[model samples]
Target: MRVHIATDHAGLDLSRYLVEELVAAGYDLVDHGPAEYDALDDYPAFCISAARAVREDREAGLDSLGIVLGGSGNGEQIAANKVRGIRAALAWNLDTARLARQHNDAQVAAVGGRQHPREEALEIVKAFLAEPFSGEERHARRIGQVAEYEATGTVAGRLEELRPREFPAAREA
Candidate 1:
């Protein structure tokens, strides 16, 4: 499997460590990186690049996945999810890592570099890479619904269709 990784300065060390470790573990890795630490570096560009690569590779029928890292991982996760067709999950532990893949079929995982010890974070990434999607009917149906919504901005419900529109004017007190 091909594993793509991206991170800002906050997670630069961890990201570099992961590239070496994952390579040793026999996974093909693509590093979309800041290359060197810069305190003011942004996460969106790198994370979005990794997510886009994963989406494109999958679209072309390749087995690929992504890993995005940051200080808290929240922003990285949010950035990765902004890419259409990307299901990015924040995984703080082994179970969440496994479930991200098993339940959601997430192609990308976000890890908090400052939240755990190096060994623990490595274990979390390994768990995420090791688990296979369950491929159950319920999971597939739910994923399909989400993908449909992403594609059309509509859902099969009474909720209003999502679109760009002005909000109602506020009432005077």
Candidate 2:
């Protein structure tokens, strides 16, 4: 797999560690700038660059993924998701990380440099990298719904189409 990694100054150390781990694990690693950390350097530049590379490869029907990191990972995730084809997930634990790929087929994982310890973060990354999309019909359908929403900025009727055929106008509660 071609894995692209991008991180701001806050995540420089962790990002360096990940590059080493990824290489030892035998994956092609792409570093998307921020080679030298600068406190004034922006996060979106690296995150979006990584996302763009991954998105471009997917456009050509190639397999690719990305990891974007920042202090809290929120802005990084937000920026990565701006790429139309990028499904970036902010993963906090093993379950969320694995499920991000398994259910959402996420191409990019947004990890928080300050959220978890080094060991836990490593585990989360490993879990995310290891899991494969489940491809169950329901999961695919749900993912499609979300992707459509992201692309068009509007929810599809397919979702409302699945609502209960009949229901009381008012909630029982």
Q: What ranges in model 2 sit over 4 Å off?
A: 158-173
Please, what are the lDDT tens digits per residue for candidate 2 over residues 30-73? 99969897999999989999999999987888778899999988
Worst 10 residues of 1 by lDDT: 154-163
CA lDDT of each candidate? 0.95, 0.89
* Model 2 lDDT, full chain set: 0.89
Clash statistics: count for each candidate: 0, 0
lDDT by residue (1-173, candidate 1, tens digit) is 99999999999999989999999999999999989999999999999999999999999999999999999999999999999999999999999999999999999999999998878999999999999999999999889889888998866862456557799999999
RMSD of each: 4.4, 4.2
**Model 1 CA RMSD to the hidden true structure, in angstroms:** 4.4
Flag regions of model 1 displaced more than 4 Å: 158-173
TM-score, candidate number 2: 0.87
